[model samples]
Target: MRQLVTVSCVLLLAVSGFAQEDSSQPRPFVEIAEQDVKPSVQAIAPIDDTNVFFLNKRGQAGVAKFSPGLSLIGWELYSKVKLNSLNSLGMGPNYSLVTASPIEITQAFDTAGDGSLDFFQGLVRDWQGRDNGVRITAGPVADSNGRLLFALSPFSIEEGQPPLARLVAWHPDSEGLQTVTESQLLISSFSVGPDSLLAARLSMPAYTEGYYISLTGLPSFLADSPDAVPDPLPKTLPSLLIPAELTGGKEPTQMCFFGENNQTKLVLTCPESNQLIEIVPEKSGSQWQGAILLRSQTPSSIESVVEMNSGLLLGGGPDGFFPLEIPAEAFRIESVNIAKDGIVLNFSEEVDRFQGVKPDSYTVKAVSLRGDNKTLMVEPVIESDGKTVILKTSEIGKGVVLRVVCQNLPSADGDALFNKTVFYTIHES
Candidate 1:
C-alpha cells in the first residue's frame, strides 16, 4: 500500500486529477473488509501511542493498553446521562478524577497502553434550560508531567451575567478544585493536540460571523518562565485556525471537538449537499495564527488533518430542537458534493471494522429509484491507500441512481459509529 499524505480533502472546489481516468485500467477501487481494531469506541481519546479510551452512545467507556497490539485491560460506566450525540463527547486525563455535568459530559484516557491516564482527569458539560438561553461548559487539561488543570464556566444561563469561563490548575497531589486560575477569551470550539491544545472563540456572537483561534498552556512556551501565570498561556499557531461564515444570511450551527489531542479528526454532515466544513492544525504557535485549510458548501465536511494513529470522531447538523446531534465544533461536516456522475457518499474516522475484512472499515452501496421499478443497479468496490477509501463502480448506465453508504463494520473491540449512506444519479455523457 502506498503511504498517502497527511492532508484531508474537501469537496468544495472542483477536485481535479483525483480519479485517474482509464478505460481498461486495473480496477482502481476494490471491495474488501478491514482488520479488527480493539477498544471499539465511537468517541476516542488518544494519549501517546500506548494508551487510549473509547466511549459509546449508551454511556459505556473502556480503556486500551496498546503496544501496537491493544489489550482491553479495564472498562466502566463513567457517565450517568445517555450519550446520544457523537460530537458532544470528549476525554481528559483520566475517567475517575473528572466531574462532568448531566453526568455524561465527556471523559478521557491514555492510548499508549499505559496503565496511568497521566494521573489527570477531564470533565465537560453544556447547560440548557426552558427560560435561560445559555450553555455552561467545563473540562480538564493534563500535561506529559504530573501537572493537571481544571477548565470551568460558571453558568451562562442569563444575559448580563459575567461569563466566568477560565482554566484553573488543580494539583492532584494537593487537594480540591482550587489552585492557579487561568482565564482567557471565552471559547466556543477547541481540542487538545499532540503537543498543545487548539481552541477558537467567536469574535462577536453566535448570530453573527467570524471567530478567532488560539492555543494555550503548552510546555514549549512555559519552558523559560519560572512562575506559571494564572491565565491561559497562548500557543502561537497560525495555519491551524478557521473562521465560520453562513452564506445567504443563514444561522451558523454550533461546533465541538470529536476527540482530544491527535488520533481523531472532526466530521459534520447534513441531508442536503454542501452544508458543512472540516478543520485541521497546519502548524503550532502561541496565538491565533493558523488558517482554515478547507472551506466549502458540500453537505458533508471533514477536517483536512489526519491523525496517523488510532481513534474515531463523528458530528452533524441540527435535527430541529438541538443544534444538530453533536456540537458545532466537534465534528462539523464542512461540505458534500455529488460525484461528477452523481454519486453521494460519506467518509470519516467514525466507521468501524468488519469481522472478515483485512482492515476494520466501512462500505458504500448504491440504491435504486422508482420505489421498486428499477432497471439497473450498480455496486462499489472499496479500496484504500492506507488513508481514505477509494470506491470503484461496477459499471454505469443511463437513468441509474446509486446509493453509497458507510456502514459500521464490526471490529475486534465492537461496533463504533453508525454507517452513512448517500445517493447519486448516472446519465449519459
Candidate 2:
C-alpha cells in the first residue's frame, strides 16, 4: 500500500509541472479572440509593450495587461475623468497618462507603477463653457517636446464672421498656453511631425460638411515665437478635399504618424473598407502636397489606433483588440500623382501584368461639387517597374476629386487588392 501511494504522488507532481509550463508560454498576439478584448472601446493607447490603455464613452479609463495565454488580459479601471466622452489618449513624459475630452485635457499618474493611476491632477481649462463658443475637436497629441497640442473649433458662430478655429499647444514646463495657428476652417484632428511639420485633418461641418486632410510645413518663425500669427494651413498643404466615395460612409475617428522624419507617413482607419489609409506628405519649394492611398486591412473594424513602443499598431473596435500585420505582398495603390495626360497609379506590390494592363481594371470618374460628374475611360499601360500603371487620359481637372475604382487587380502573390477605390483631389494637371 505504501508503494502505490508514493507512485500517485509522483504522477500528480508531473501533471502540475506540465500545466504551469504550458500556461507560462506567451501566446501569439494575432490570435486574440473576440471574447478576449473589451467592447465599446473609445480610445486605445499603448501604456507599454505588455500593457494597453483604453478609455470608454463613460469617461472611465482602464489598463489592460498582456499575459501569457490571454492577450491583453487584466482589465483594471483606475481613473475616471469628468468628461462624458474621451476623444483621445496619449502617453506623456513624466506622467502616467494624458487624455482629452471635448471640454478639457487631464493628466493622471500611476505613482505606484501598478497600472493604477492614483493621482488625478492638473486640468487645462483655458477655454470656458461658452468661451468663444469653441471646444476641443480632435487631438491632444504629445509631441516630442512633451507639449500637449490640440485643436479647437467653434460650436457657434456670429453671422458673417466665418467660425474661427485654432490650433493650441501647452507645455508641461510652462504656465502660458501657446497659440499655434488660428484659421477659419475647423481643425478637427492634428499631429506634429519632426521639425513642427503639422499634419491636420480638418472639417467644415456647418456649411459644407466637408472633411479635408492637410500636411503643411509649420512656419519656422512660429516655432520660436509663441504669439506669432501663422498662415492658414489650407493655404499651406493646400488641403486634400475628401469626397463621399473616399470616406467609406464615415469620417475617420483619428489619424496617426509613423516612420522617420524624412519618410513620415500618416495612417487612419476606414471602417467601411475595413482597411487603413496611408497619406504620404511631399514638400517642394515651400509648398506641401500629399497623396492618400489604401494600406492594410484586418478582420475587424479598428478605431482609436495607437502606435506601440516597438513600432507595431494596436487598435480597438466592436470586435476587439488586434494588431495590424504587414500582409504578404498586400496589393494597394500607393500613390495617385498627377500626370501630364491624366494620373499615375503607383502600386506597392508588383503587378500580375496580365490583369493590371487591362483598362477595365480601373474605372475613373471626375467628380465636381457643381453637379457635373464625368466618366473617363482609362488607357492602362503598365510601366517598366511592374507596379506603376499610367492611365492616359485628358480629363484630369483642377478642383476635382478623382474616384478610381480598382477591380480585378491582383498582386504577383495572387492576393487581391485590399481596397476597391481611391479618391484623389487634383489641383494641377
Candidate 3:
C-alpha cells in the first residue's frame, strides 16, 4: 500500500545587516582566522539563516550561529563520524542536519527524540549489506514531502553485470526504504522539481557524453514494501535527454532546483568543464534548452555552487571564496573622461590584476587624418580601487580617433572580460 506524505512549509526571514558595503572587498588571499576551526573545512551546509554547519575531511562536524553583525554568536562541535567522505548535507525540520556519508545517511536533530537522538546513529547497515563498492554520491535530498531520496552506484563493476544506478527513497512515515527507479546508465546527481518531478544526470562509462532525464509520476513509485523494485522501467515515465554539447562535454557533478512554480529551472555544476549550466523551459513551455551561464579559468575549478538571494556563492579548488552576481553580463565601461594629463577609464566593477593593469596587455592605436592606424606608446596606471585605470599619452589632436584593445582581462571573481575594444573620438580642444 502507498503511504501519503505531507509536505511542510516554513517561513524564513531574510538575513539583514549582512550585505557587504562597496568600500569593503573580499580578501584576495585565504586566511585562517581565529574563529575558524583548526582543521580545514571540506563542506558547508546552512541549517538556517543564522546557523551554519561545517564538516571536515576527517568527518568532524561543527555548528556555528552568526549574529546580525556576522559575528560568531556561538560555536560547538556537533558530531564525529567513522566515515572519511561526507558526500552532501541537507536541512530538515527543526534544525536537523541530514548528512550523507559514503555508506549511510544520518540526520541529527537539535531536539532529542526519546533521549536516543543524542546517541542515535540513524545508520541503516543492512541497506547495502557489506557491499563496500556500493556508494551514494549525489544526494539525500529532503524533499518538501518529508522523504529523503538519493542516488546510488557501484564503484567496482563486474563483467556481464550491468552498472546499476538506483534512486532510493526513505519515508519517515512508513519507516520504509525502497528503490524508486533503476537504470543501466550512471546517475550522478538528482533533484526534485515542480509537480514532484525527478530530474537526474545520467552518464555512461568511458563516454564523454551525458544527459539529463526528467522522470514523471514519482508519487506512484513510493512504496511501503522494502523489497519493492519496479520492473523493466515504467513506460509512462517521461524522460528527456539534454544535449551533450549543452553540458560542455562533461557530466554534471551537482544539481539543484531553483525558482518558483512555472518558472523553476535546473542548475547544474560541471566540474571537469568548470561551468555552471542551466536548463529552462522554452518560450512555448513545452521543450527545454540548456545554456552555459558561468565558466572558470585554468587555475580555478568550481567544486560547489549554491544560489543564495540574488547571487551564487562559489567555492572550489581555488583558495578563494566569493559571490558571483547572477545574470552574468559583460563588465561595461562606466565612464571615460579626457583629463589634462591622461585619459581615465572606469569600469562597472573591480578588475583583477591578471594582465589587465599592464600596458603591454593593451594596444593603443591612433587614427591619423589619412585614416591610418598607428600604435601609440602609452603608460597605464591602475587605480588603488582596481576598477579605474589611466592611460598617459601624447597630446591629442583634432579628429583623432583612438582605439584601445584590451586582452585577457579578468574580474575579481575570475570572470573574463567580454568586450575587447573601446573606441574614443577626440573633438577639437
State which candidate, 1 or 2, has the greater lDDT: 2
Report the C-alpha lDDT of model 3 over 226-314, residue by residue, as the tens digit: 34455644321214444355446766666666662335666666667666555543221332322222232223455444444332343
State the lDDT at 97 in candidate 1.
Answer: 31
Lowest summed lDDT across 10 adjacent residues in model 3 is found at 4-13
Write one digit per residue (lDDT tens) for candidate 1, span 249-307. Answer: 33222333444343223333212333443433332232322112222343333221112
Best TM-score goes to which candidate?
A: 2
Error of 2 at 225 (Å): 6.0
**Backbone clashes, candidate 2:** 0
Clash statistics: count for each candidate: 80, 0, 0
Please report how far candidate 2 places residue 354 from its true position, in Å.
3.3
Of 1 and 2, the candidate ranking higher by TM-score: 2
Residue 96 of model 1, lDDT score: 33
Worst 10-residue lDDT window, candidate 1: 1-10
TM-score attained by model 1: 0.37
Q: RMSD (Cα, Å) of candidate 2?
A: 15.1
